[model samples]
Target chain A: MLILTCPYCGVDCDETELGAGGEAHLKRHGPGSTDEEFESYIFQRENPRGVHFERWRHAMGCGKWFHAARDTATLEVFGTYVAQAFEPPQEIKDKITAKRPGWTWRDVA
Target chain B: MSDVVTALDGATFNGTIAVEDAGLTGMITLRGDFASTSFQNAVTGVSGVNFPGKGEVNSVGDRGLAWMSPDELLMIVPYDQTNAALAEITENLGEEHHLAVNVSDARAVFRLRGNGNVIREVLAKLTPADLRVAALPTGRVRRTRLSQVPAAFWFSAEDEATLICFRSVAEYVFGLLRQSAAEGSEIGYF
Candidate 1:
């Protein structure tokens, strides 16, 4: 079981005590009005292999939504930060030193 | 007062044996000022279950119990010992910084245990508590939402893997478990 750090409760919670909020922080663009845009927004998914950002909810305990960084394959959690906070954990600094696709300093970095 | 023994209706699951008030168990809700020394001493003196100076739980004997939070603890004792336990704590602590509330009436419990996938099937339909042995391990306790009702989940040291849920939610929760079991079998689950 993964220990999810609840940004609100300030505690590491068991995975069983939480629910995933699906792909985290998905962004939307202006009125493209095209099938590709709609499909990419709804059906397309990015199953990242490395450190991925995601949103999680502490369903059974405190009802709070927060961003959690986890490694997809090994499930090694990087850290969890409050939803409103703009800064990422200091540990992610080196890993995100360079930019990648679908990433912004506001997101991946 | 006359002892009332009314059959608690819809308070259990089907195909699973349930025994209520059959064994000795006690439930106590301790609400006190965590900042007050009197409150701390009263709890430690009563059940030998001291507040978690750091963690979320602390215990004295195998049976003595205490679960931690910011300012409250839900304590448990053997069935016959609840009243005396509350009274002693109250008398010693006085009414300065503590209040020993007997929640025996508000709370109740049912122990569930059996061989086969019986226990697993029941729990799968009930709460989100991980039934995985590695996660919960036997004897570990967690207070969580079971069937959307506030309750506690613990592994028992019995021959069969035993678990307990709140008595008030027994009926609905049990019915759901039975339904899930039947649904599992209907889908060819053994």
Candidate 2:
């Protein structure tokens, strides 16, 4: 099982103690947005094989949601951060860059 | 209020490990900013136990306080004192943005005690948390899953653990614990 350290509780919770919340840092598109934007917001997701960002909740621990940067295929977690962040922190991105080299996720550098 | 019955109702499993229902108790889920002095003071005043740090547990007499998370704590008291404890906490919080939920009826607790690695052996099949004495010493609270069910548990004493789970799944959790304890009796072929 993947061990994820909850940003809120500082507990390295196992995957069984967490709930996966799909992709992270998605901008919600409502009312004024075009159909394409709304569709992208609701349905489209980046199921990348490597160097991906995800939202996970320590459902059985802290009950707080957080973000994780990792290589999906290798199961190597780059880092975990608070859920309030709108984007992956720069330090985490740099770590990912150092490991994966030239890897990028959307607007995150 | 109707009479409250425990999940096991005094049932005891006599095996290498022993599992017994902790019986009905008052359980309050308190949520607030742990950093807030007012919140800390309020909880201390009501429970007579200090605000436990992360994964810590403090006991005063028969009442115990367990840190569930950064902002949440679980208070265990006598079953009959549930409402009074809720009122005391509510009155103590004053204007703090917090929640004092009387969850005594929503959860069930069990105590596991044994000799010679029985407790650890049974728990290994359930939680991913390290139950070794060096890692999880007595008085350490862990919010982890027991197999497929979510549970809050702690090492109340050496070779003993107290596990609390939702009332709806108490039967399943108890049965799973018994099954795991029973499995300890069999010699592994591997």
Candidate 3:
């Protein structure tokens, strides 16, 4: 029973209480994008060896998107934090803001 | 009535003891740096009960009380006593970065005695508290879970321990207890 700390819930609960979705930072194509683009996004995955980003679900408590850093080789989870509710660093923010819901890249500040 | 639900909507079985809506008790969750003198004084002034302060219970003339945690405590008293307790507490500390939350409405407590040992076994299957006398010696409190419910389990008296649940989930919790008990058997809990 591994005690995984939830960034949002702020509790060290059993891993059974959570479900791993997949790698985080997986980009999904927008509606106007081509089918090929979406397919690549859906099927392709980067199986990193260390410090990989992943998405986890809080099955027993509040359901929210949270990011975590895990070492692939050791399976040691270093830290977990809530997903950015707003803007992030310049690079990631630019990419995300470009494809945000209801707004195009040009629409974001 | 075979199944008597209390005023708080908690179901009370014929064999189990129930004390519902006993009084509007005030439960204040206190959190601050444990090593801070201000925090210590804040607790003392409010309860007149010295901070057993680290991880234990300290009583104050049967009214004000403090139950400790890792870095926090739960101060409980009669509802009417909160204003005065708060007054003395704030007066002593003046200004500090601490939390004093009134969680009175969030919890419902039960006096689970008589067959406590049996109940403890039933709970051990789901909770993490070690009910063994050696592990959780009498008069001790341990915070753990009940299925999915977060609870504070403690021996409140010689043969009694209080089971507190969130107000919104009290009814569901009561049902869970009834289902866990087998039919045609006695609740011979120690």
Candidate 4:
């Protein structure tokens, strides 16, 4: 069972205690955006085999949603941050870079 | 007039473990900034127990507070004293960004006690939390699922725990507990 520490409640919640909220930090493309942009925003997802950012809610624990940076293949979570964050924190990026050198997620290099 | 009865009102079971309804305890879900001095003072005034930190439980006499989350606490008091406690908390908090909800009827509580290893064995099957004394200890509260159902539990003593779950699934939770306890007896768990 994967355990992720909830930043709000300080509990290392088992996966059973959490609910996956899909990709994190997606900029919503609404009415003003073109059809392609809207489609990408709603339907497109990066199911990369390496580093990925996702949203998770501590459903059974704190009931707060948070973000996690993890390796999709290994399921090794690099870090977890509060949901209010717009992007993965630099320290988390640095940690991921240190482990998997030359890895880049989206525009955060 | 219709009489209201709890899910476990007439239910009784005997085995190596003992389980019983806590019986209409007053429960309030309080949400606010835990670091706020006013919030702390208000809660202490009402519950007589200081506000607990994350995963902690504090009690003074029968009134108690269990930290449900970073900004949430579950207040437990005698069923008859719920209104008084609620009023005291609401009055003292003043205008803080806070919420006080009477959730007494939304939950069902069960007290469990047994000899060595019995409680541990039963809970181990249901939760991933480490039930050992070194990890959980007394006064540690855990908000986690018991099997597939969401529940909150705390160690009241080394050999005792209090389990609270939504009233809707109280019977199912009780059934699971009874089955586990009975199975433990068969295997000489304690």
Clashing pairs in 2: none
Weakest 10 consecutive residues, lDDT, candidate 4 chain B? B181-190
Tell me which residue pairs clash in candidate 4.
Answer: none
Task: Give the lDDT of residue B186 in candidate 1.
Answer: 33
Where's the lowest-lDDT run of ten residues in candidate 1 chain B? B181-190
lDDT per residue (tens digit) for residues B7-108 in model 4: 688465666678888777899999999889999999988888877877899976679999998889999998778888899888898788999998888999
Per-candidate interface C-alpha RMSD? 4.4, 1.2, 7.4, 1.2
The weakest ten consecutive residues by lDDT in model 3 chain B span: B14-23
Selected candidate, larger TM-score, 1 vs 4 = 4
Candidate 3 lDDT score at position B37: 85
Q: Highest TM-score, which number?
A: 4
Off by over 4 Å in 2: B183-190
TM-score of 4: 0.93
Which runs of model 4 end up more than 4 angstroms from their true locations? B1-4, B183-190
- Candidate lDDT (C-alpha), each: 0.59, 0.84, 0.59, 0.86
Error of 4 at A7 (Å): 1.4
Best candidate per lDDT, number? Answer: 4
Query: Once model 4 is optimally superposed onto the true structure by TM-score, how far is the C-alpha of residue B24 displaced, in angstroms?
Result: 1.6
Total backbone clashes of model 2?
0
Cα displacement (angstroms), candidate 1, residue B161, comes to 5.8
